[model samples]
Target: MSYPESLERYAALGVDTEQALQTLAKTPISLHCWQGDDVNGFEGSTGDSGGIAATGNYPGRARTPEELRSDMNKAGSLIPGAKRLNLHAIYADAPEIPDRTELTSEHFRPWIEWAKEQQFGLDFNPTCFGHPMAESGFTLSSADSRIRQYWIDHCIACRKIAADIGEELRNPVVTNIWIPDGYKDVPVDRAAPRQRLEESLDTVLAADVSKEWNIDAVESKLFGIGVESYTVGSHEFYLGYAVKNQICLCLDAGHFHPTESIAEKISSALQFVPSLLTHVSRGVRWDSDHVVLLDDPTKAIFEEIVRCDALDRTHIGLDFFDASINRIAAWVIGTRASQKSLLLALLEPTDELRKLEAEGDYTGRLALLEATKSLPWSEVWNEHCRRSGVPLDTDWMKDVRTYEKEVLSGRV
Candidate 1:
């Protein structure tokens, strides 16, 4: 682990090292479960398999619920600090929920029990694609009334399940609704589909579940494999709906233009929306759902959250699936990057920077910002991993290699 000299260097800037560690320990990042199985849920699904396409097929993907959970256990051990599990409706490992429309809380009992053992907070998302119903490249916004109602029922049912799970765990579940609804060609009437989506959302959210147990959020998309021309749940639509309904709006990092600043949107949304749900993802050209890295955007995001004092109102979660590499490593890297970003943000001398800005001393603000880039951040991170009882170096890769050889390789 790093020495005490690194801590002293951070203190010279008026930042408290011990307090930053404690704050990082309490910040819970939701680890996405889809990475374990390449988004191939055990629902026996078909049809338009959503627009979410996980590329590359490295050997040894988890094939069962027990296997996936075991893999998560290994990844969780290496990723320190508080952690949560973000699940999809399709991941339910029960015989009862034979179809998406008939899903119930009972179907997720196994998951709830597993979460209890892992001591993880929970979050959920409704499966709006990968079924015969969504083949038309639309779900809730489909012109067909029957198609729209089926998805609406599924979404409403998912919220109930989320509420029950959150009630059991005593941690509110952020139930997000995202649909692959759009058209490939310029629509003769664009307003009709969005209008239909509006009514369906109103019906789905009609449930009176306690906000303490379940917080609802709506996710929007830019474009997908099939829906290249338009997406029904665009940012404008969901932003308006979330504000009007007094709910949270989910800002997925990959769900916008490549150059768009997701970090900048946090303060903008918090000004009107009750809360925010961030799906921390990295996009190259489109929503490829690449494994998240400690890039500039990721760093800027948490810094902005801290600067605006919106930690309590913000929910941080991972959203990526890359089948080409080791799945366990993907989880550990992304979750750790998020934790590291938060730690870096907490260690910032924000008061001094803001004080400079308030006095219109732009030179001082920029100078301090540049100097912060060379601080002893890695030393603090090394100590954090040491105290969290996780590996502080490349030792984690050895664990994944052993699991791949002894456990994952055994799967047929």
Candidate 2:
């Protein structure tokens, strides 16, 4: 259908197509770099002892930073709208021997420089697992003080690195902390570990990083692989911490109960937290980071955010790494799915729907919502892609296959 024809359909529903398209254009989706390399950064370590792991041996996984960047570039071109790149501390380009604890921003200079070239804002994370110290299945909340101190230093260093990047880029870099601290069986003493965690976090956040450059965020997981009985950084713990510490809460959609709806959690979180950083992912049965889809959950989350008028307040980032498929294709699919959901939300006649609810017209509200399902949203999405100078169809995947043949196949 023509753009004008689609616009008229949406207009009939009291939705402004032009305004929706513009809103979708500027909304930034933070694309994760881990998807290109299956969370294996340059460290060349397989000690991701705890936490969720990307489960696939997909060929053409980018081994070097250069390859990763090229792959990200390919995926970024196909993605519509603004984007920011999220990095883990493991992705650091250390000039010398790898040191997880004594890391600095200098170790990630190459990343900052390249991100600058790409005109992409950078976000960062502290790798609290996947090292000798973290192999004990704990970090900040480790029973051993020395081991706990190591993770603390690492987390503190990450904040500084994030601050430097943000200072140079002149945009706040979100430094998120997600520790895989839990047990396979029931824990005899849960409160003690949580107390230790509270103390360790205090030391980490005590560093006087400028808020202008750094936004501190703590991610809570319901549970990870073996850490089933208890997660030290549960949602309740981080929610309270985020409120008291005045930091951003990083919510991963897949971290909650499968039956739970994270879309419904947006407004509640915004009320307490200063800002929010969300990691959008899809989980099949558990917290398996499958590639995000344009499913009901994904669409509902974006719709809720739009309805809450928290688009600017919430930072949306993709966190799934589906190594089972073409890495670049996975990136494009997941990121595009998110963009499509945002576009759908923006295209909704939210104001009219709200008016319906306010006037106690419940039936009209459901009717208008049901009617929106048939509107030509694809036309607006295609138009957005055309304006962004990206592919409007499956043409982008051809580039990925070409890259796989020319660049990736030769990796071994």
| TM-score for each candidate, following the candidate numbering | 0.98, 0.97
What is residue 362's positional error in candidate 2, in angstroms? 0.8
Model 2, span 184-246: residue lDDT tens: 889899899999999999999998888899989999999988888899999999999999988
Candidate 1 clash pair list: none
TM-score of model 1 (CA atoms): 0.98
User: Which residue runs does candidate 1 get wrong by more than 4 Å?
Assistant: 1-3
lDDT value for model 2: 0.89
Clashes of 2: 0
Q: What lDDT tens digits, residue by residue, belong to model 1 across residues 1-412?
A: 3548878888888898998998899889999999999998888879897677889988878888888999999999899999999999989888555788888878888889989998999899999988999998888998899999999989988999899999999989999999989878777788999999999999999977778899999998888887888888999999999999989999999999999978989999999999999999998887888888898988988999998999999999999999999899999988888888888999899988999999999999999999999998989988899889999766888888898899888887
lDDT (CA) for every model shown?
Answer: 0.90, 0.89
lDDT for position 129 in model 2: 76
